[model samples]
Target: MLVDADDCEIVGEANGSAEMERLLIESAPEVVLCDTSPADALRVIEALSGEGAALVLLGEDHSEYQLMADAVLPGWAYLRKEADRIEILGAIRAAGAGLIAVDRSFSLLPGSAFPLADAEILPPDETLTAREREVLQQMTHGLPNKQIAARLNISQHTVKFHVASILAKLGASSRTEAVTSGARRGLVSL
Candidate 1:
């Protein structure tokens, strides 16, 4: 589906690796845009290699995929989900031309070339309830408590409660921080 422009035609779409493999074999578009988690992106990339299609991956975490792309697929582009429309369009076009287009902010290497020694160490497994996880997922869209409550078929008060719990569990002072932390921890996808 076309998101913000009419000039670019969407040849195909897929939700998972198997569907993506089928679409890649059927359509073989010059460029493929996939929005998924890092692990899933790896699976999709592996599933469609040698198909001669450039890949543009949009995800919450880029470092893992960046490393993989550098080692395996030079034509792949990994952009953060929060990337602006211009960046996304540029990445797609560049990838279509068989070139690499990466977000400069994210490094293509693993681990700390520049480590933050004092970074907050979140617990290895901060358990979030199912409802709280759903609320946090909605928060990633920048939705308000009212809209999230309506979408979840819950009361606004309940949404607020879940949000508060999410923030506390994530050690975040605000909704934005909560989403950011959740994404970094692989607890939520963007």
Candidate 2:
């Protein structure tokens, strides 16, 4: 595919990290587009860390989006190599503007989850009170405040307080975010 070479300047290309590092220092481009597997992408991402040029990775495996998205930051994205010229170009433009452009194929929206490996586990919140843990357990069952209060034999006000504390400890802005974060940390199973 020509990818309409006229759309943007092709600074340079490299086969691996060593060559890419040299090209990065020499060209100092605004955004770097890489076509590689998720494993290979990790090496390039590490090499380009703090190098100033934003990255747009085009990985071959769709299931690796989580591992790749874990590396997400301003102007950093994981797109599919099968992305068309428009999608690729749009990602490049977004990267240059310090914005992220996640691939449409990924179901990575808020509250969505991908199975996590044990080695990639997040830190569990050890600061939660026993009562707070109980509240979180109820939350995983989608219990409303009134129901939770009934189950825990606590006042609705007390339930709200525990919920607020749970959110704060999990660094989540919403109940769903809290639950997702909680599950990721093995605080709750859902």
Candidate 3:
């Protein structure tokens, strides 16, 4: 089953660890959002080591997954369930871009800690034009071409033209891939 939220899409859903691993192998999505216990989420993350998929874990507290993220998964995000929608989406976007995006709430947790060295910093490319960057940011919001055009006060043809240029510049074959590349290159923020 597929579920769509914000600018992210869930290509598969699993009820148990075994099923989740199977789905991960089969679908190979760019990012996996898991709302399970820390232990369960750890198992899933370990199982996906070679799959090249990023993770965004949601739980009640930083204690749930902080250590694992710090020690095991460097390019992952652990967000509290009560996190803001923008932060949640940002985490997902960052994970898809192969970056760590831990929520600020975690730092406020009593005795919470993170390994500074675990954070990954991607270098930005300055190839995109100002207009193209605007289009790319709107793409991260999951906007369709028409809506992007209307919001940017441009015609649909212009939006399409920008999208095509973005794809070509990023060497991406699809819109989603282009957005992922943009995020990875620090060119777009969710």
Per-residue lDDT tens digits for candidate 3, residues 58-93, read 877666554545444435788887766777778888
Model 3 scores a TM of 0.52
Question: Which of the two candidates, 1 or 2, achieves a greater TM-score against the reference?
Answer: 2
Instruction: Order candidates by lDDT, high to low.
Output: 2, 3, 1
Off by over 4 Å in 3: 1-7, 70-74, 116-190
TM-score of each: 0.51, 0.56, 0.52
Against the true structure, candidate 1 reaches a TM-score of 0.51
Over all chains combined, what TM-score does candidate 2 have?
Answer: 0.56
Give me the candidate number with maximum TM-score.
2
Instruction: Give lDDT tens digits, candidate 2, residues 38-157.
Output: 667777877666777888888766555455445544476667778887788888888878876667555343333343455434446436777987899899888899999999999999
Least accurate 10 contiguous residues by lDDT in model 1: 108-117
> Predictions ranked by TM-score, top down?
2, 3, 1
Model 3, backbone clash pairs (residues 3+ apart or across chains), number: 0
- Report each candidate's C-alpha RMSD, comma-separated, in the order given: 13.0, 7.3, 13.0
For all candidates in order, the CA lDDT equals 0.73, 0.74, 0.74
